[model samples]
Target: MAIVLRYVDSLDFVKERFIGIVHVKDTSSLTLRNAINEVLTSNKLSFSQIRGQGYDGASNMRGEFNGLKALILQENDTAFYVHCFAHQLQLVVVAVVKKYDGVSDFFEQISLVVNVVCASCKRKDLLREQARERVQKGLCSGDLETGRGLNQVTTLVRAGETRWGSHFNTLISLMKLFVDVLVVLDFVKEEGGSLANRQQASGILAYFKSYEFVFYLHTMYDILHLTGTLSKQLQRKDLDILEAASMVRGTMEALQSFRNIGFAIILPKICNLQNIGIDLVKQAPQLLEYMAALSPCDSFAQFDKSKLLKLGKLYKYDFDDSDMIDLEGQLGIFYHSCIKDERFTSLKGISDLSRLMVSTGKHRDRKCRKMFSKLKLLKTDLRNKIGDEFLNDALLCNVETEALTKVEDEKVMERFEKMYAQRGQI
Candidate 1:
């Protein structure tokens, strides 16, 4: 387990600092809790100091009764939990969509076809030759414009399962070179040197020509296009929670709109969408709501004083009753102070607002969201599937297993001995 702390400094500027890492025996909640306490004790930080927890939507981390979130909350009730935003995005678009057999099979066949076409020098050359001929035909028919560097032909890029961009590019390349890909597959099927190669080509050709594949290809292309912008924005280092929420809401609206019109247009072939994004929430609703209430968009048009006060109440250890009482009045004064002040006129996010508050001597105040991209990068497009520790891997340097075991053995084993009540088992 790794921890990246999002905390305010003396200057009240929000900072993300990489913190301690613990490689536990396993990811069970009890083990995680022990590891967490071990890190906190080493740093002289306390359980009471934790005001929030965010993890990806793994059952081990976010499970209602036994997750790490629940385990921590049991020790300290103030440590509320929220699911990771980017993981929620992948849930809605990539992971959920692939649950459908047609969509699943579509991607499977695409991988097979790309592999076959790029298997050797001769077959790859055939693809480029076909693509060149396609551009030539398009140019002659007035379907494509001549340009200095516009029509350069290239081989198809195979989609990587972990990259939405790669999947999108594969869809675009397939659409552009649909006829060309078909030609290559046909030649291999009829005149290939090996029977196994011919059989594979024949099966792929049959699958590609099926109505199911074509529908899935075009449908996923549109859905991915709709989601592409939000996905990029979510990964941006500068993105704050408020802007992310807005973009997420916008993406959901786009998806809903697409469903309304897209299904209407293709109502006749709408049988296989049973498992695509059945219950996707952009993120935990409570998290979005709490964060959304703190937005400074449109000169604090969305700011809710009551909700902002609730934030302080959420972290009561950091804010007492006097602070809360003072906060209620401060909220009103800050709103006008910011509105009348020209320095805060163009502010559209919480991070910018936090910084402005500090610069203007409102410093006695504070507080997050861009590290999920780092988490995603750790998942790496090469993995067969993203494991539960994707969040843990991002924030801390990997500890050498031998050193980690030796370094933390006493504390961990002592804790386990106390918990298990069998001292001699060690």
Candidate 2:
């Protein structure tokens, strides 16, 4: 499969207090090297500009002596490549859960079951039809159990620690409705194979009782709160989404004053997690150093795929395929809302403007220019309402421009000239 590099702009909860996209691609080593060099050379950003580098536990990105991190660090020794804490935590979760054959089997069975449920329009229609009938007949009808696709599974799994508990209901509720699923499974068996992986199914059901499972369940809430929306309450971090940025600044200043005393208090709390030998937890002092070394080039390379898969594995404990399915449905709803909802006009315009500003070189076509013009006009009105910091963030939305090759650079120039001439003709 051809994998395109996806760039996501997000906040670094532990360091830098700035939002930037971590770039990752799905190309070969040669392609990756060329792509990284192209981004660095074309953008005129030095290795010094990088404040942090984060990658999954992958040979390509994180190889100790010769991988992407090493190559970048050679260019700028100060570049602090931190293993993505989220990715590492995901790995730990997977390693912990896989101790029981049942958990692994559960994932495999759920995957198959989900496939059976959503196999086709015919199958989906049958499920809905049966569900409706069950409801009407006074039979207990519950959530439609299905397998989690990659995206759906990831969302629920990686959903911050606090949200996982809410999802527990979402999972067991599906299990309660499993009998209804067996009804659908009968249709699947008639069409093809049996719905349950009977051999592994019982073991998975048994594994749920393991102490590891219980401990994982206990930590899910704390983990969710830390990773998800609850971490926003860490007023000292000064993340943007927190209400009243100025007020947070004051709180941060107060924290700075108590740094020695605070560390005396907080070090013990941090050490608890570090005792397990998680590097990020141990390297708390390097937070600023890591931030100082992050680079724009890191934003365009292929992200660690295995790490994402690992996260999916960890997430499987609390979620199944239905959660993923619902996420997709929700995404579809959000997408349609962006396209059709009148209330989203201002938000949509801002999103478009942000995209236009980030577009670079030949990629910058008529649409971008038009959007920029409109954005420039809009800014005059929005400036007073939105603070400079917020406005700057909107402008910097595409902080890393399109990764262009030397050949692509020439093409971009040629295309720009043609478009420029065409505009002149008009």
Candidate 3:
């Protein structure tokens, strides 16, 4: 199990730190809980510190009664559960596509094309070479502009079940390389090759040139474009729940507006959707109250003192009687000060207000993020197939690279020697 610690520091910045990974022999709620306890105990943290839970929509992880989410809530009720926004959007994409058989078949065809074109290094190289030549010719003929980031090639990216955003990337790259893909498929169809390969390529070439495929292609492009923005925003570290909620609302409205147009326009658009994050709020009244009160939107326009005070009482362990006495006055002053301050005025939305608040020295001190970008190296295709223990070791070293640099080389060598010496004997 991979553990991450997200907490607000004394400075009030929300920080997410990748805690070390824990190995589990099984994934029962109890077993998972114990693994969690072990990680926290080793780190000298406790259950009472948990403020929220986020996981993908997995039955074992987010199950209502016996899942790990419920088990944790049993220990800390204040630690509310939240389904991952990106995962929810991915589910939306999966479901919305299935609503129409045409859309479903479109994606299936896309997957098949990706598989056939990317089947071998020779084919991949052929596609790249063809795309490169086409772009070069266009650039020379003034049909394409050249710049630092413009007119660049889009390498075809195959979509996968594990990477939800892969569909978006695949759609875009394939759109850019549509001509190149057709050329590659045609070559495979007519080339001196096995009979089965020839037949499959010939069929794919025919599909690529069809009117139905083109219709579904543009339709999904528009739909995924809107949802893709939401997915990227949801994964941002600096983004808060309030900002995300607003973004989700905006995206849903845009999608609905797109749907409301006649079928002629809707031919290249999508319909059917569901409101997200509503259930989590419905499950916990305190959560609803907290989000309502904590919104620093409209220059503290939504600040509610009574609900905030109620939230304080709900999490009594974190707020003492003395703190409680002072919180109300502080909340009042904070709200008014933000309203009067020019720095807070003309802000775009909640995220801007959140950054301004954290910048002020008056807020609590919270240790937060700057290391997550380094985490991407561990998940790239070439680096993904790694064991948990080694993954954690790499994470620890990467997260604290400066600290690792300060350690003596001899000490590192001694540990490595000890680890490998036994292997050598075996």
Candidate 4:
């Protein structure tokens, strides 16, 4: 178990510290609670000082009853639980992709393609050579642009179950090196040492050449590419929940827009690969619904209470009961009360100042310029009130250091010398 502490320093900058990791026998709530308490005790801290707790959406961690979060809250109710946003986004992608049969099958086939082509070093070398030849041909014909780091030899990347961005990279590599992949598969089908190997290659090659597979491949590439961008943005160390929420809503809106008009946008590219069109009208709605529903829980953050109530009323035609009415009423009351509180109305978390600084630097709006001037004055006042040493310490509080012995330094130098000698030989 890992323990992290977040705090605002004298400079009003948000900082995170890694306390330590605790080894536990099991992941039961009791065990986790005890481990956390032990770490707190050893560090001379108390549970009352904690203001927030974050964890993945696990039953043992975030359950309302008999969970680690619940136990912590029992001790100090102020330590509100914030579920891991990145993990939630990852789960959303995984669930949505697997919920659709066509998209799911596309992923499975891509995985198989990677595994088959990279099973042997001979096949890998052949792929590299073929990719090199294609790049050279394209360069000579002036069909492809050549520059630094452009048109390099391509390799198949295996898709990972946990990392959604890897799927995007795999799809892109496959599309870029489509011909080379087909050539390698064809070679394996004909010259394989065993009948079973040849048959497997033949099956994969046929599937790779299918129109249905090609269509889904391009379609999923477009979809995953968008979500993959969101996943990367959410992983940034400086991002705050508000910015992350805003990004999530923007991505959902983009996806909805794509669902309505993406066929026309993607069809031209698909036709370039194969001069055929498959009817997707009957099959697209379900996939679009699944994709739109991926982050339903986070979608609510996009709207104000009034808009939400209006949306609930507008969608009442689909529901034949009063659940929508009850939901809207409850949401109206909750948000109405929360909006009146000063804490909810004026609270700007850690990322606000940094975001303002960026806006002031990049934008030339009157409000932004005035806000930047006020921010500069505030910084000067704070620096004068709190000495420079305190601000310096706050900046350097998270820096970790280690002492290197003389013998270790010599070992590093010797290793570098050996590497240099080997490089000369090469």
* Candidate 2 wrong stretches, greater than 4 Å: 1-34, 134-179, 186-425
Candidate 3 C-alpha lDDT tens digits along 272-307: 322211211112234654666666556666778898
How well is each residue in 1-426 modelled by candidate 1, as lDDT tens digits? 566777777666666666644668998988988888887889899788887788877788898999989989988988888666765676666666555667777788888989888888998898889888888898999999998988888777888765666778888888877888889899999988899989999999888778887778877787777666667787776777777777777777777776656755754655657335323335436656776776767877887888777777877777789888878888788877877888887887777777777777785643324344455556577763755455454344342232345556689778888886783788
Global lDDT scores for all candidate models: 0.74, 0.41, 0.73, 0.65
Measured on C-alpha atoms, candidate 4 has an lDDT of 0.65
Off by over 4 Å in 4: 267-426
Summed backbone clashes in each candidate are 0, 27, 9, 0
lDDT of 4 by residue, 1-426 (tens): 556677765444577665544568999999999989887889898888776787877899999999899999998875767666566666777776666676788788888889888999999999999999988888899999978989876699888888778989999999988899998899989998789879988988888778778688867787777777877887787865556666766777667666666756767543332211111111222212222221213322333545444434433333335756566566555544434544344434424433433443421211110222332443475476754445333333332211223237667667877775655522
Best by lDDT: 1
Return the TM-score for each candidate structure. 0.74, 0.40, 0.75, 0.64
As for TM-score, the candidate ahead, 3 or 4, is: 3
> Taking the tens digit of each residue's C-alpha lDDT, what string does model 2 give over 1-426?
111122224221122222222233664444565566665566575555554566557787788787878877776665667564335434554563355454444444444555555666776677666655655555334333434541121111111222233434434434445555656666555544444534333443444455544333333333333332322343232332212222334433443443334324433333222222121112223332222221112231222333333333334433367655544444344334434544334432222333433442211221110223434754685475865556544544423232222246567667777765565522
> How do these models rank on TM-score, best leading?
3, 1, 4, 2
At residue 239, candidate 2 shows an lDDT of: 34
TM-score of 2: 0.40
RMSD of 4: 15.6
